[model samples]
Target: MTATIIHLATPEDTVRLGQDLGLALRKGDLVLLSGDLGAGKSTLARGLIRTIADDRDYEVPSPTFTIVQSYPDLRLPISHVDLYRLSSADEVDELGLDEALMEGAVVVEWPERAEGALARPSLSVALVSDGEGRKALIDGETAALARLQRSLAIREFLAASGLAQAERRYLLGDASARGYETVAAGTEQPLILMNSPFNPGGPVLRDGKTYMQIAHLSQSVSAFVALDRLLSSRNYTVPKIHAGDLENGFLLLEHLGGDGVLDADGAPIIERYEETIRLLANIHQQAWPHEAEVGDGTMHHIHEFDRDAMMIEVELLSDWYVRRISGIELDGVQKAAYVAAWDAVINQLNGCETSLLLRDVHSPNILWRRNEVGIRRVGLIDFQDAMIGPSAYDVASLIFDARVTISPYLQDHLLGVYIHERNSAGSDFDEPDFRKALAIMAAQRNAKILGIFIRLDERDGKSYYLKHLPRIQTYFDRVVRHPALAPVREWCEKAGIFSPES
Candidate 1:
């Protein structure tokens, strides 16, 4: 229902527009290209196709003769259709466009030839010759229109960063609102463009704070940039911040290679996991500052993982996971009991040695730079939500990685590696106290994860997270049996939190 005009000064500019839009695109999208002959529609389509394929020089021949060209091997398989040769609009169905959309996106050139047969949610691009250049009049429904706007915003940000000519390639996006892209200018080293828009911490729940604010989640990219500098200064392998627009939440960061700690078969490589634990041990041994200065001379405070934050997180079990599987909303007394259960566990944390918790030290966030020496071999990312908490929290995060199934034997091996490294380096490392904290943190994290997975399924319409619930439940049962978590164990048993499927 809305329209935006993008001015393209040259054929390359048209291609750049396609590349920008390509980054915003998702599967099942339809792109209608309407333009006169020699209006560069094919050129733009080629750019978009090449970007999805992650290759700058991918071969994209015009579909004039073939009628349709399907690239099935790309990130999202896209079908480029030339409706110019179709004798009738009904022929559009014969081309299997509906089937193509089921798998990926479809781009239709000379859409007028279809005579409105292609009725779907589409981004309409009308190209017109403007002197020697071309202008694109883009219009669409809400989702498609929002995609174009986001793409244009990225273009504006890149232009301001003086990398207007950089080749933009979609890197990855997470469950959060953050997105990342790799932008390389000419033959220069590729850099990561972190697009993290400010999250207006949702409706205030208590004490005039949203869930994000109550839990100390980073509301902006300032935390990431500040933490990157802080960790890098301590000789850790966090991405070096090259440039950033803190106000707008865009950061051009060093592209730490995508070599994760997992092996080729998607299983954890014991060596890399051990090395990562050693790296974490080294990190926990050091005393970190409570606040670090951002590049803009503003202070970024690292919040303490206090009782309110912990209790709020654990309540996710009662609020989402319990209600989802059992359809039983806990009454006020039940919710109060749940809070009381975690109080004892949190109190026990008082005796544990405390340090900074990476909060998300798992397989996905960790990178194994094999060529790098010592602790630098372990590269860290996604530490923006880092908190000042028990040192054992990070160890628990690794030992019981939510994504990877770390067997009991393997978990013991990695935990032993961490304890050995910590005790060898640090003074007064009490093994019993550390073990108790690890158990408490592990149970707490797994409880939060169960509720989060269910919340993602019901609230966000993301069903994929449901598959991980069984794995997390098995891990939760193992840790909740610890003597340190008796109160939590008793509450979970009564609430039927152990039986997620039943």
Candidate 2:
């Protein structure tokens, strides 16, 4: 079953549709209103809020001047944010819209201004005005949308094409614009199928009867291309691209299923960490041939890890999450300590050799699969940001992960296993030197993660990441606790980098 697109006959119908959707709204759910100017965007938002609030006198005007307007009087405090006034993505966070998202329902006008800021919706209502009528398309997640879309009868036409069953099934999961879907043709076989008006980077069904991820072109396309090239030489598993219309940012790919490595239940923490480290070792071992193809050069360079760039990100954390939200002002001594600690870490990194490092190697980027031996195997994803850098960069990312917390014991055991594997692989790395490199890289990775989490919540309206800050900080503390990193730790402490009050 897939979601069906319906047309509304009048403005009244649009309001009614909004009211219907408002009745179903829940906490932490996002409603994105996308339409042209005067396409009844605000009118629809007004109807939704009115239905929930039921207060006739509540003024529901366009929030043009004020980026976000909150109405807490309703059953669920509704946040009416108008991004039309936003000058840049950074300004979105300053408006404190993320807080509104956390408390109640969010009705966003000109949401495209902060498109990636919101999570994938549970329902998306696109209003297209035509003459005296409007088009109202409702996309429900999984069950509701699938049942509706299948009733529309376009499924047969899509299936007859090269599109596979699995492709159709996956597309049915899309709660946004229809592009392609993955469906299961048989109990074991899946195929990729196409949806009309294909949006670049949106998911699509491929000829092999599997669903592929095609969400956005700018970053996803580049990332997948790099992953494709890497898979050609390594034993690692990434979603295989069956068919790609790169110009349109659409690709048919093999579905790796929804069960990711990090989502494994009751798995031993050390085992998970060990599997991940082994895969990283495999990635580092497979050297790219001089003639091997490379992805677009937009990836970050380790050489770009200069003093200025590092300081800018450190300042971002200090300004946004720490100072602005947490109200912790850095004293002069603390500031100087942070600077010195950062410099020491960077100076150490400057001396180590570099390799192809996947910048984002956290939980979400890895998929866990069951192997024949009943043990779980880890598969990597989201490597478009891969770059030439220190091998420890990836190790730090896995051990000091932001999404999940790994105990110090597991971290040490995993690190030992990784070192053993690397040494056995005939690499001539100095143990002492490698340990130092790991500490240096761990500090840099944690610093970058802090800034990213802030950006994700404040700038992007994804506050779920805020809860992981303490865990990530623990990783920083662990690294700095080492004798080799004592100087850096002293610097961080002096700077109040880990100040409990801060």
Candidate 3:
């Protein structure tokens, strides 16, 4: 419903904007190209095609003579069409444009000849001459237009922040909507570009609060900036923030190198694991303020990982995992009992002394920097969801990681290392109490992961997460053995969740 007009002052601007559109393009989408001859329609199309192919030097021959050209090697098929030579809309149909629409995205030049056959809620790019440059107006439906606006926003961020001329390369993206890129400009030590927009999830799950509110998830890039300062102050390797547009959710951070804690076989490196544990041991003892300043005279108030947040995370088990394994959702009575069980444990968990919890201290978020000294050797990313919670929570996250299996022997050794380190700093650190809390937190974390993984599969179609269910089940089987989590163990047994093992 919104129209966005971007001033494409240069060919580079046009190309970068197209790349943004290309990244957001999905299968079965239509992009209508409208412009005069030599109006940069072909240039824009080339940029879009090259981005999808991930080839900077990709040759995109104009399809004016051929009517249409298809690229099958791309992640999705792309059909580049030229309708100027077409006689009528019927001739367009004879080219099997309908079938191409069924298969992949279609980008059509001179779309007006089709007489509005292109479909509504479509992206129409109008490229007109503007003095020494070109200006483009993007008109489309709300959803599609929103995506294009985000792309323009990113381009503006890069431009206004002096990174307009940087070379960009795709880095990584997760099951979530977030994506990252590496920016290299001249001799500048390459920076990481995080394109994480605040994702406000759907309807009121409870108390008029959405899932993010209950889970204490990062709703803005400001959270990452704040937590980055908090962790960096303690010598943790949260990436150094270079420039950021918090409103647009674009962050340019110092590139922490590519060495991960996982070896070639994808197992956790013992040496790195020990270092990660030691880092957590050291971090948990520090006094992190609830209020952190994120530079530019802005103060970010960190939200605590309180009862509602803890309970909401653990409820993921009942939400998705139960339906997958038991073939039904948790009924009213079962849900009530599950909630009561978690509520009681959360109360006891609150009694334990708390510290900053790196909610995802697992292998993927950890990078091994061998040359860096001490805790800085473990480069931390994704601590945007960091909150004040039990130190044992992060301990559980590290040892009982979801992505990588920490063997029983290594798990015990690492657990020992973590406990000894904590004891060194905390005089009144109760080993037995901490161990019980670790078990409680592990069970909660593993259960939440089970639901999250299954939801990723069922709803988001990320079946790759299903591969970790056995490991998660094993973690559940082990952690629920704690007397404090007996209620959860009983529920799991009744649900027949532990009938199989890895």
Candidate 4:
């Protein structure tokens, strides 16, 4: 695949672009930043670092004299290396450049010195200083670059047509999936256009007042239809679908706001956590009285937690990740122990009552609306994976997330609140039993995530998720330590699953 190139028209634009890009960077990434002395290289680097490490006091000077300056305090260790003073490729190798690249995000100033030694970069930002401002040309094979290019191109086209002003630029991309594009608006309201070959779920846009969109038919057509049905029944704050061009997968949706609930930095973490958990409870608790009569009966039952299916998923994890990439051998005893652990989890979940499960209930999937009222006020997104399953499954998924850690105290408190609320509504759910199931579900979920993360990195070449291994392992550790699953915990410990501490 070819890399996308973006034109950064101004100094502010260059810095903004850098800051945006920095949010997507993770450990074990190679970002080659090349530019002349006055090309705003350090300025862009400073902006990128500031986004990741908010303190921003670290002097982002040219690493000419030092050759390499490492910042380990940040979530990902950043090695700012200047190869301007290097004599040859051998000198680059002598500096242990490869070792540094293996561990963290490596920003090379004069990568030409070690052109042959450097691996394929996730992103290569080349900055050129215009007499008036600066232009940034970002090149890379990654999906981020592709999405960035498409978005920049779209914005430029809209600007040239006089339909979009400079102030109303918006860029959206899936950092996890590695696809992105941008949109701009004119005096009239902006329309959501679904033009990507990938992401068939259509796009969303907002005018100055409200969100507008046309719905397009795709693999996720049922999801959109369900969302529309949900809007009618509940007073939830999801984006309203204004128009639809079903054939082309286009949608005009009411724009909620420029920022999502996840973007609220000023809000207290505990407050956000409580609000999010409460919203989840609302969805799980509020059931359609005619759900069985409403549509097709393809939904999996909560009580039907299949040991065979669970074992199959667990074996796939072993085959695709552990055995394939790590080359880890699971002997007869090891295999039997893993299966037993997985079977115990399945049996535990089978006893729970079924509820509406929003499988992907992480931070990114939720949108907090300030104007909405009550616990059900949160805006939900990415519900395509919705299913009927154990209530604790989604709860476990949210609390023991691999990407971000919810505080242990808050997680426990939310569990208490969720169970209390459910019981108050005449549900016969048991708290102690639910907590045990949650621990098992968490272990199963983390195991699946570990496999998925590895597949994304090794198979798809999206290595950004590799850094999340430690966080995922932490979740596994917490789950395995549960007294109810002590047998499973001992087996995992022997297998070195939590060997690498985050």
Candidates' C-alpha lDDT: 0.88, 0.61, 0.83, 0.61
Cα lDDT of model 1 by residue, 429-453, tens digit: 8999999999999999998999888
Pairs with steric clashes in candidate 3: 1-142
Model 4: residue 411 alpha-carbon error in angstroms: 1.4
Q: What is the lDDT of residue 238 in candidate 1?
A: 88
Clashing pairs in 1: none
Number of the top TM-score candidate = 1
Q: Residue-wise lDDT of candidate 3 within 443-500, one digit each (tens)? A: 8899899999999988886688899999998988887888898677776677776632
Q: In model 3, where do residues sit more than 4 Å from their true spots?
A: 1-3, 59-68, 71-77, 83-104, 112-121, 175-177, 199-201, 347-350, 424-426, 459-464, 500-502
Off by over 4 Å in 1: 57-61, 65-73, 90-103, 187-189, 499-502
TM-score of 3: 0.89
Comparison by lDDT, 2 against 3, better one: 3
Ranking by TM-score: 1, 3, 2, 4
Error of 4 at 229 (Å): 3.0
Instruction: Judging by TM-score, tell me the better candidate of 2 and 4.
Output: 2
| Window of ten residues with lowest summed lDDT in model 4 | 209-218
- How would you encode candidate 2's per-residue C-alpha lDDT over 1-502 as one tens digit per residue? 3444556676665665555465456676677788888778887788778767754345787788987788887777898888987788766667766677688878777878874766566566677765567776566476434433432333334333354222222233122233344544454735444332333432344332211221112233444565556664565676666555443344555666655545357334555667888878767766543222434444422222345544555545555545644468777876676666666657776667566776777676676666522222676646654555677878888887777887777778888888888889997767777778888778766766676677777666667777888887777777767666666666556545564223
Candidate 4 residue lDDT tens string, 1-502 = 5444456676667666655566556566788888887677777777667655654355676677999888777766788888888878877667766687667677777787786787788788887765566666777766656544544444444444453333322235343332222223442545443233324332443232111111111242334445444544677666665444333333445555444444346332556567777776777776643232112333221222345434554564565556644577677877877777767657766667566665677766666676667765566655534555667878897787666766678678878777777777786668787788788778777877777788777766778788888777677777777776776666666666554223
Model 1 vs. true fold: TM: 0.92
